[model samples]
Target: MEIKLTDQLDQIYQDARTIRHHVFVEEQGIAETDEFDGTDSDAIHFVGYVNGEPVVTARTTVTKKGVHIQRVATEKAARHQAYAKQLLEYLLDQPMFEDAPMFYLGAQKTAIGFYQTLGFEKYGEPFEEVGIPHVNMRRTHSAADHHDR
Candidate 1:
Protein backbone atom coordinates (compact mmCIF):
# COMPACT_ATOMS: atom_id res chain seq x y z
CA MET A 1 0.00 0.00 0.00
CA GLU A 2 1.12 3.53 -0.80
CA ILE A 3 -0.26 6.63 0.82
CA LYS A 4 -0.02 10.11 -0.69
CA LEU A 5 -0.88 13.46 0.86
CA THR A 6 -1.53 16.74 -0.90
CA ASP A 7 -3.00 20.19 -0.42
CA GLN A 8 -3.60 20.78 -4.09
CA LEU A 9 -6.78 19.51 -5.66
CA ASP A 10 -4.68 17.55 -8.09
CA GLN A 11 -4.88 13.95 -9.25
CA ILE A 12 -4.21 12.53 -5.81
CA TYR A 13 -7.02 14.58 -4.33
CA GLN A 14 -9.32 13.61 -7.17
CA ASP A 15 -8.58 9.96 -6.48
CA ALA A 16 -9.58 10.50 -2.87
CA ARG A 17 -12.88 12.01 -4.01
CA THR A 18 -13.60 9.01 -6.19
CA ILE A 19 -13.33 6.65 -3.25
CA ARG A 20 -15.52 8.93 -1.16
CA HIS A 21 -18.08 8.98 -3.94
CA HIS A 22 -18.19 5.22 -4.07
CA VAL A 23 -18.39 4.67 -0.33
CA PHE A 24 -20.55 7.59 0.77
CA VAL A 25 -22.66 8.46 -2.24
CA GLU A 26 -23.17 5.14 -3.97
CA GLU A 27 -22.95 2.58 -1.20
CA GLN A 28 -24.19 4.57 1.78
CA GLY A 29 -26.76 6.70 -0.09
CA ILE A 30 -25.36 10.00 1.08
CA ALA A 31 -26.43 12.94 -1.04
CA GLU A 32 -23.60 14.07 -3.29
CA THR A 33 -24.19 17.63 -2.14
CA ASP A 34 -23.64 16.61 1.48
CA GLU A 35 -20.68 14.43 0.73
CA PHE A 36 -18.78 16.97 -1.34
CA ASP A 37 -19.49 19.82 1.11
CA GLY A 38 -17.49 22.60 -0.65
CA THR A 39 -14.61 22.03 1.76
CA ASP A 40 -12.35 19.85 -0.36
CA SER A 41 -10.71 22.85 -1.94
CA ASP A 42 -9.25 23.75 1.41
CA ALA A 43 -8.67 20.47 3.14
CA ILE A 44 -5.51 18.40 2.92
CA HIS A 45 -6.24 15.02 1.37
CA PHE A 46 -4.78 11.57 1.91
CA VAL A 47 -5.15 8.75 -0.56
CA GLY A 48 -4.01 5.17 -0.09
CA TYR A 49 -3.39 2.93 -3.05
CA VAL A 50 -2.98 -0.79 -3.49
CA ASN A 51 -1.48 -2.16 -6.69
CA GLY A 52 -1.71 1.39 -8.06
CA GLU A 53 -5.44 1.80 -7.53
CA PRO A 54 -6.77 4.18 -4.93
CA VAL A 55 -8.77 2.27 -2.33
CA VAL A 56 -8.75 4.39 0.79
CA THR A 57 -9.14 8.13 1.32
CA ALA A 58 -9.37 10.73 4.08
CA ARG A 59 -9.05 14.49 4.40
CA THR A 60 -8.14 16.83 7.24
CA THR A 61 -8.60 20.51 7.88
CA VAL A 62 -6.59 22.30 10.50
CA THR A 63 -8.96 24.34 12.65
CA LYS A 64 -8.63 26.45 15.77
CA LYS A 65 -9.49 23.41 17.87
CA GLY A 66 -6.98 21.13 16.17
CA VAL A 67 -7.03 18.81 13.16
CA HIS A 68 -10.55 18.04 11.97
CA ILE A 69 -10.64 14.65 10.24
CA GLN A 70 -13.35 14.02 7.68
CA ARG A 71 -14.44 12.03 4.65
CA VAL A 72 -12.63 8.87 5.67
CA ALA A 73 -13.58 5.95 3.44
CA THR A 74 -12.23 2.71 2.09
CA GLU A 75 -13.59 0.82 -0.88
CA LYS A 76 -15.85 -2.02 0.27
CA ALA A 77 -13.42 -4.66 -0.91
CA ALA A 78 -10.62 -2.93 1.00
CA ARG A 79 -12.34 -2.80 4.36
CA HIS A 80 -10.57 -4.39 7.36
CA GLN A 81 -7.24 -4.24 5.57
CA ALA A 82 -5.83 -1.45 7.80
CA TYR A 83 -5.39 1.05 4.97
CA ALA A 84 -7.47 3.71 6.67
CA LYS A 85 -5.77 3.08 9.97
CA GLN A 86 -2.33 3.33 8.46
CA LEU A 87 -3.23 6.48 6.53
CA LEU A 88 -4.49 8.15 9.69
CA GLU A 89 -1.45 7.11 11.64
CA TYR A 90 0.70 8.58 8.89
CA LEU A 91 -1.38 11.76 8.88
CA LEU A 92 -0.96 12.39 12.59
CA ASP A 93 2.80 12.32 12.31
CA GLN A 94 3.02 14.81 9.46
CA PRO A 95 4.77 18.12 10.06
CA MET A 96 1.64 20.20 9.63
CA PHE A 97 -0.02 18.62 12.66
CA GLU A 98 3.02 18.63 14.88
CA ASP A 99 1.74 21.50 17.03
CA ALA A 100 -1.94 20.67 17.06
CA PRO A 101 -3.45 20.01 20.44
CA MET A 102 -5.69 17.17 19.33
CA PHE A 103 -7.38 15.37 16.47
CA TYR A 104 -11.12 14.95 16.18
CA LEU A 105 -13.77 13.46 13.95
CA GLY A 106 -17.52 12.94 13.85
CA ALA A 107 -17.40 9.17 13.67
CA GLN A 108 -20.26 7.12 12.32
CA LYS A 109 -21.73 4.86 15.02
CA THR A 110 -20.48 1.78 13.25
CA ALA A 111 -16.95 3.11 13.21
CA ILE A 112 -16.61 4.34 16.79
CA GLY A 113 -14.81 1.22 17.84
CA PHE A 114 -12.31 1.51 15.02
CA TYR A 115 -11.40 5.04 16.02
CA GLN A 116 -11.17 4.05 19.66
CA THR A 117 -8.41 1.60 18.83
CA LEU A 118 -6.49 4.57 17.41
CA GLY A 119 -6.73 6.32 20.80
CA PHE A 120 -9.83 8.44 20.23
CA GLU A 121 -12.37 8.94 23.00
CA LYS A 122 -16.03 9.73 22.69
CA TYR A 123 -16.97 13.04 24.28
CA GLY A 124 -20.47 14.01 23.25
CA GLU A 125 -23.98 12.66 22.98
CA PRO A 126 -24.72 10.66 19.89
CA PHE A 127 -26.23 12.64 17.07
CA GLU A 128 -27.27 12.33 13.46
CA GLU A 129 -25.03 13.53 10.65
CA VAL A 130 -25.71 13.25 6.94
CA GLY A 131 -28.65 11.08 8.04
CA ILE A 132 -26.43 8.62 9.85
CA PRO A 133 -25.93 8.15 13.58
CA HIS A 134 -22.63 9.60 14.71
CA VAL A 135 -20.74 10.73 17.79
CA ASN A 136 -17.97 13.21 18.31
CA MET A 137 -14.59 11.80 19.23
CA ARG A 138 -11.20 13.29 19.98
CA ARG A 139 -7.67 12.20 20.67
CA THR A 140 -5.32 14.41 22.60
CA HIS A 141 -1.87 14.63 21.03
CA SER A 142 1.37 14.05 22.83
CA ALA A 143 4.49 13.23 20.84
CA ALA A 144 5.52 10.67 23.40
CA ASP A 145 2.03 9.24 23.64
CA HIS A 146 1.47 8.77 19.92
CA HIS A 147 4.56 6.72 19.22
CA ASP A 148 3.46 3.93 21.50
CA ARG A 149 0.30 3.34 19.53
Candidate 2:
Protein backbone atom coordinates (compact mmCIF):
# COMPACT_ATOMS: atom_id res chain seq x y z
CA MET A 1 0.00 0.00 0.00
CA GLU A 2 1.09 3.57 -0.62
CA ILE A 3 0.12 6.74 1.20
CA LYS A 4 0.23 10.29 -0.10
CA LEU A 5 -0.28 13.72 1.42
CA THR A 6 -2.12 16.28 -0.60
CA ASP A 7 -3.38 19.79 -0.03
CA GLN A 8 -5.20 19.75 -3.34
CA LEU A 9 -8.60 18.11 -3.05
CA ASP A 10 -8.37 16.72 -6.57
CA GLN A 11 -5.76 14.22 -5.47
CA ILE A 12 -7.86 12.61 -2.72
CA TYR A 13 -11.34 13.95 -3.25
CA GLN A 14 -12.97 10.77 -4.51
CA ASP A 15 -11.40 8.36 -2.05
CA ALA A 16 -11.95 10.60 0.92
CA ARG A 17 -15.57 11.19 -0.03
CA THR A 18 -16.26 7.50 -0.58
CA ILE A 19 -14.73 6.47 2.70
CA ARG A 20 -16.61 9.12 4.60
CA HIS A 21 -19.82 8.22 2.84
CA HIS A 22 -19.48 4.61 3.85
CA VAL A 23 -18.58 5.28 7.44
CA PHE A 24 -20.65 8.32 8.31
CA VAL A 25 -23.52 8.32 5.81
CA GLU A 26 -24.34 4.72 5.03
CA GLU A 27 -23.17 2.85 8.09
CA GLN A 28 -23.57 5.41 10.81
CA GLY A 29 -26.22 7.74 9.38
CA ILE A 30 -24.30 10.82 10.38
CA ALA A 31 -25.59 13.94 8.69
CA GLU A 32 -23.82 14.98 5.50
CA THR A 33 -23.16 18.43 6.87
CA ASP A 34 -21.46 17.04 9.96
CA GLU A 35 -19.27 14.74 7.95
CA PHE A 36 -18.25 17.24 5.30
CA ASP A 37 -17.41 20.24 7.37
CA GLY A 38 -15.89 23.02 5.25
CA THR A 39 -12.54 22.51 6.91
CA ASP A 40 -10.85 20.50 4.21
CA SER A 41 -9.22 23.61 2.82
CA ASP A 42 -7.12 23.92 5.95
CA ALA A 43 -6.57 20.26 6.75
CA ILE A 44 -3.93 17.86 5.48
CA HIS A 45 -5.60 14.85 3.88
CA PHE A 46 -4.03 11.43 3.58
CA VAL A 47 -5.14 8.67 1.28
CA GLY A 48 -3.87 5.11 1.24
CA TYR A 49 -4.12 2.81 -1.72
CA VAL A 50 -3.62 -0.90 -1.96
CA ASN A 51 -2.92 -2.39 -5.38
CA GLY A 52 -3.68 1.06 -6.76
CA GLU A 53 -7.17 1.09 -5.24
CA PRO A 54 -7.87 3.65 -2.57
CA VAL A 55 -8.46 1.65 0.59
CA VAL A 56 -8.06 4.02 3.52
CA THR A 57 -8.41 7.74 4.21
CA ALA A 58 -7.85 10.23 7.06
CA ARG A 59 -7.10 13.89 7.69
CA THR A 60 -5.43 16.06 10.30
CA THR A 61 -6.35 19.53 11.50
CA VAL A 62 -3.73 21.50 13.32
CA THR A 63 -5.15 23.16 16.40
CA LYS A 64 -3.55 25.26 19.10
CA LYS A 65 -3.51 22.25 21.40
CA GLY A 66 -2.46 19.50 19.01
CA VAL A 67 -3.17 17.70 15.77
CA HIS A 68 -6.72 16.34 15.64
CA ILE A 69 -7.25 13.23 13.56
CA GLN A 70 -10.54 12.90 11.78
CA ARG A 71 -12.45 10.88 9.19
CA VAL A 72 -10.32 7.82 9.66
CA ALA A 73 -11.83 4.98 7.63
CA THR A 74 -10.89 1.91 5.68
CA GLU A 75 -12.64 0.30 2.77
CA LYS A 76 -14.48 -2.84 3.95
CA ALA A 77 -12.12 -5.02 2.02
CA ALA A 78 -9.20 -3.34 3.75
CA ARG A 79 -10.41 -3.82 7.30
CA HIS A 80 -8.40 -6.10 9.63
CA GLN A 81 -5.37 -5.53 7.46
CA ALA A 82 -3.83 -2.78 9.56
CA TYR A 83 -4.36 -0.10 6.92
CA ALA A 84 -5.74 2.36 9.46
CA LYS A 85 -2.84 1.75 11.77
CA GLN A 86 -0.39 2.25 8.96
CA LEU A 87 -2.11 5.41 7.84
CA LEU A 88 -1.99 6.75 11.41
CA GLU A 89 1.71 5.93 11.76
CA TYR A 90 2.44 7.74 8.53
CA LEU A 91 0.51 10.75 9.76
CA LEU A 92 2.35 10.88 13.04
CA ASP A 93 5.71 10.63 11.30
CA GLN A 94 5.01 13.70 9.22
CA PRO A 95 7.19 16.66 10.22
CA MET A 96 4.10 18.75 10.87
CA PHE A 97 3.19 16.53 13.85
CA GLU A 98 6.53 15.07 14.90
CA ASP A 99 7.08 17.57 17.67
CA ALA A 100 3.50 18.23 18.64
CA PRO A 101 3.07 17.67 22.37
CA MET A 102 -0.27 15.92 21.99
CA PHE A 103 -2.30 13.96 19.49
CA TYR A 104 -6.06 13.84 19.78
CA LEU A 105 -9.01 12.12 18.14
CA GLY A 106 -12.70 11.61 18.84
CA ALA A 107 -12.99 7.87 18.72
CA GLN A 108 -16.11 5.84 18.20
CA LYS A 109 -16.87 3.88 21.34
CA THR A 110 -16.42 0.59 19.53
CA ALA A 111 -13.03 1.59 18.22
CA ILE A 112 -11.50 2.93 21.40
CA GLY A 113 -9.51 -0.25 21.93
CA PHE A 114 -7.81 0.21 18.61
CA TYR A 115 -6.73 3.70 19.58
CA GLN A 116 -5.59 2.54 22.99
CA THR A 117 -3.29 0.04 21.34
CA LEU A 118 -1.57 3.01 19.80
CA GLY A 119 -1.22 4.61 23.25
CA PHE A 120 -4.19 6.96 23.20
CA GLU A 121 -6.20 7.25 26.41
CA LYS A 122 -9.78 8.40 26.76
CA TYR A 123 -10.07 11.73 28.54
CA GLY A 124 -13.73 12.31 29.39
CA GLU A 125 -17.09 10.62 29.55
CA PRO A 126 -18.62 9.41 26.31
CA PHE A 127 -21.10 11.72 24.70
CA GLU A 128 -23.29 11.57 21.66
CA GLU A 129 -21.78 13.27 18.66
CA VAL A 130 -23.69 13.03 15.43
CA GLY A 131 -25.69 10.10 16.79
CA ILE A 132 -22.69 8.04 17.77
CA PRO A 133 -21.09 7.64 21.15
CA HIS A 134 -17.65 9.18 21.21
CA VAL A 135 -15.05 10.22 23.72
CA ASN A 136 -12.15 12.54 23.44
CA MET A 137 -8.81 10.76 23.49
CA ARG A 138 -5.33 12.16 23.82
CA ARG A 139 -1.81 10.83 23.86
CA THR A 140 1.33 12.65 24.77
CA HIS A 141 4.06 12.08 22.23
CA SER A 142 7.04 10.02 23.25
CA ALA A 143 9.86 8.45 21.29
CA ALA A 144 8.75 5.05 22.50
CA ASP A 145 5.13 5.43 21.42
CA HIS A 146 6.17 6.55 17.97
CA HIS A 147 8.73 3.82 17.54
CA ASP A 148 6.48 0.94 18.53
CA ARG A 149 5.89 -1.19 15.44
Candidate 3:
Protein backbone atom coordinates (compact mmCIF):
# COMPACT_ATOMS: atom_id res chain seq x y z
CA MET A 1 0.00 0.00 0.00
CA GLU A 2 1.06 3.59 -0.70
CA ILE A 3 0.15 6.48 1.53
CA LYS A 4 -0.55 9.95 0.16
CA LEU A 5 -0.67 13.16 2.15
CA THR A 6 -2.27 16.43 1.18
CA ASP A 7 -3.24 19.73 2.76
CA GLN A 8 -5.79 20.76 0.18
CA LEU A 9 -9.09 19.18 -0.68
CA ASP A 10 -7.69 17.68 -3.80
CA GLN A 11 -8.20 14.30 -5.41
CA ILE A 12 -6.41 12.53 -2.60
CA TYR A 13 -8.71 14.13 -0.08
CA GLN A 14 -11.76 13.30 -2.13
CA ASP A 15 -10.71 9.68 -2.06
CA ALA A 16 -10.47 9.90 1.70
CA ARG A 17 -13.99 11.27 1.93
CA THR A 18 -15.25 8.26 0.02
CA ILE A 19 -13.78 5.87 2.56
CA ARG A 20 -15.02 7.97 5.46
CA HIS A 21 -18.48 8.08 3.93
CA HIS A 22 -18.61 4.31 3.87
CA VAL A 23 -17.08 3.53 7.28
CA PHE A 24 -18.26 6.49 9.34
CA VAL A 25 -21.55 7.53 7.85
CA GLU A 26 -23.14 4.56 6.13
CA GLU A 27 -21.88 1.68 8.25
CA GLN A 28 -21.57 3.32 11.68
CA GLY A 29 -24.78 5.37 11.43
CA ILE A 30 -23.05 8.67 12.10
CA ALA A 31 -24.91 11.64 10.69
CA GLU A 32 -23.15 13.15 7.72
CA THR A 33 -23.27 16.59 9.31
CA ASP A 34 -21.44 15.35 12.42
CA GLU A 35 -19.04 13.23 10.44
CA PHE A 36 -17.86 16.11 8.27
CA ASP A 37 -17.66 18.69 11.10
CA GLY A 38 -16.56 21.40 8.60
CA THR A 39 -12.89 20.95 9.56
CA ASP A 40 -11.41 19.15 6.59
CA SER A 41 -10.60 22.45 4.90
CA ASP A 42 -8.01 23.18 7.56
CA ALA A 43 -6.61 19.75 8.26
CA ILE A 44 -3.86 17.71 6.71
CA HIS A 45 -5.38 14.60 5.18
CA PHE A 46 -3.79 11.21 4.73
CA VAL A 47 -5.06 8.48 2.45
CA GLY A 48 -3.72 4.99 1.93
CA TYR A 49 -4.31 3.04 -1.24
CA VAL A 50 -4.01 -0.60 -2.18
CA ASN A 51 -3.87 -1.51 -5.83
CA GLY A 52 -4.75 2.12 -6.58
CA GLU A 53 -7.95 2.06 -4.55
CA PRO A 54 -8.24 4.19 -1.48
CA VAL A 55 -8.88 2.06 1.58
CA VAL A 56 -7.88 4.05 4.65
CA THR A 57 -8.06 7.68 5.67
CA ALA A 58 -7.09 9.95 8.55
CA ARG A 59 -6.40 13.61 9.08
CA THR A 60 -4.46 15.85 11.45
CA THR A 61 -4.82 19.40 12.61
CA VAL A 62 -1.86 21.22 14.12
CA THR A 63 -3.06 23.22 17.08
CA LYS A 64 -1.35 25.02 19.93
CA LYS A 65 -2.33 22.16 22.23
CA GLY A 66 -0.73 19.52 19.98
CA VAL A 67 -1.39 17.70 16.75
CA HIS A 68 -4.96 16.45 16.81
CA ILE A 69 -5.50 13.24 14.89
CA GLN A 70 -9.02 12.87 13.51
CA ARG A 71 -11.26 11.15 10.97
CA VAL A 72 -9.47 7.83 11.20
CA ALA A 73 -11.30 5.17 9.22
CA THR A 74 -10.60 2.09 7.17
CA GLU A 75 -12.89 0.44 4.67
CA LYS A 76 -14.86 -2.49 6.09
CA ALA A 77 -13.17 -4.95 3.77
CA ALA A 78 -9.73 -3.62 4.67
CA ARG A 79 -9.86 -3.93 8.44
CA HIS A 80 -7.10 -5.84 10.31
CA GLN A 81 -4.59 -5.09 7.55
CA ALA A 82 -2.59 -2.49 9.53
CA TYR A 83 -3.06 0.14 6.80
CA ALA A 84 -4.10 2.69 9.39
CA LYS A 85 -0.99 2.01 11.43
CA GLN A 86 1.31 2.32 8.47
CA LEU A 87 -0.38 5.52 7.32
CA LEU A 88 0.06 7.04 10.80
CA GLU A 89 3.67 5.98 10.96
CA TYR A 90 4.18 7.65 7.61
CA LEU A 91 2.36 10.76 8.79
CA LEU A 92 4.61 11.10 11.84
CA ASP A 93 7.75 10.64 9.80
CA GLN A 94 6.96 13.66 7.68
CA PRO A 95 9.28 16.60 8.49
CA MET A 96 6.31 18.73 9.51
CA PHE A 97 5.22 16.42 12.31
CA GLU A 98 8.45 14.65 13.22
CA ASP A 99 9.13 16.85 16.23
CA ALA A 100 5.58 17.55 17.28
CA PRO A 101 5.42 17.48 21.08
CA MET A 102 2.16 15.56 21.28
CA PHE A 103 -0.44 13.66 19.27
CA TYR A 104 -3.98 12.81 20.26
CA LEU A 105 -7.31 11.44 19.03
CA GLY A 106 -10.84 10.57 20.11
CA ALA A 107 -10.71 6.86 19.47
CA GLN A 108 -13.81 4.74 19.03
CA LYS A 109 -14.32 2.36 21.97
CA THR A 110 -13.57 -0.65 19.81
CA ALA A 111 -10.34 0.88 18.51
CA ILE A 112 -8.75 1.92 21.80
CA GLY A 113 -6.49 -1.09 21.78
CA PHE A 114 -5.41 -0.40 18.22
CA TYR A 115 -4.38 3.15 19.06
CA GLN A 116 -2.58 1.91 22.16
CA THR A 117 -0.30 -0.19 20.00
CA LEU A 118 0.68 3.02 18.23
CA GLY A 119 1.91 4.52 21.55
CA PHE A 120 -1.25 6.41 22.48
CA GLU A 121 -2.63 6.07 26.02
CA LYS A 122 -6.08 6.81 27.33
CA TYR A 123 -6.26 10.03 29.30
CA GLY A 124 -9.71 11.45 30.06
CA GLU A 125 -12.85 9.47 30.80
CA PRO A 126 -14.85 7.96 27.98
CA PHE A 127 -17.47 10.07 26.29
CA GLU A 128 -20.12 9.82 23.61
CA GLU A 129 -19.76 11.48 20.22
CA VAL A 130 -22.13 11.25 17.29
CA GLY A 131 -24.00 8.53 19.16
CA ILE A 132 -20.92 6.39 19.56
CA PRO A 133 -18.70 5.94 22.58
CA HIS A 134 -15.23 7.39 22.35
CA VAL A 135 -12.23 7.95 24.59
CA ASN A 136 -9.57 10.58 24.32
CA MET A 137 -6.13 9.10 23.82
CA ARG A 138 -2.79 10.87 23.66
CA ARG A 139 0.80 10.13 22.88
CA THR A 140 3.74 12.30 23.77
CA HIS A 141 6.34 12.37 21.08
CA SER A 142 9.97 11.52 21.67
CA ALA A 143 12.19 11.44 18.60
CA ALA A 144 14.31 8.64 20.02
CA ASP A 145 11.49 6.40 21.16
CA HIS A 146 9.26 6.58 18.07
CA HIS A 147 12.11 6.34 15.62
CA ASP A 148 12.76 2.76 16.59
CA ARG A 149 9.48 1.61 15.05
Better of 1 and 2 by TM-score: 1
How much lDDT does each candidate structure score? 0.92, 0.85, 0.89
Tens-digit per-residue lDDT, 1-149, candidate 1: 99998999899999998999999999999999999989899999999999999999999999999999999999999999899999988987788788999999999999999998888889979999888999999988763396465
- Give me the displacement of residue 71 in model 3, in angstroms: 0.7
Q: Which residues of candidate 2, in runs, are more than 4 Å off?
A: 143-149
Q: State the lDDT of candidate 2 residue by residue for 33-138, as single tens digits.
A: 8999888888888999988888899988888888899899887768999999999878877887877778899999999999987788899788988878899998
Q: Candidate 1 regions off by >4 Å?
A: 143-149
Candidate 3 lDDT over 56-127, as tens digits, reads 999999988789999999999999999998998887667897667888899999999988888888998999
What TM-score would you give candidate 3 relative to the actual structure? 0.94
Instruction: Please tell me which model should have the higher TM-score, number 1 or number 3.
Output: 1
Model 3, C-alpha of 91: deviation from truth (Å): 1.3
Those runs of model 3 whose alpha carbons end farther than 4 Å from true positions after fitting are 143-149
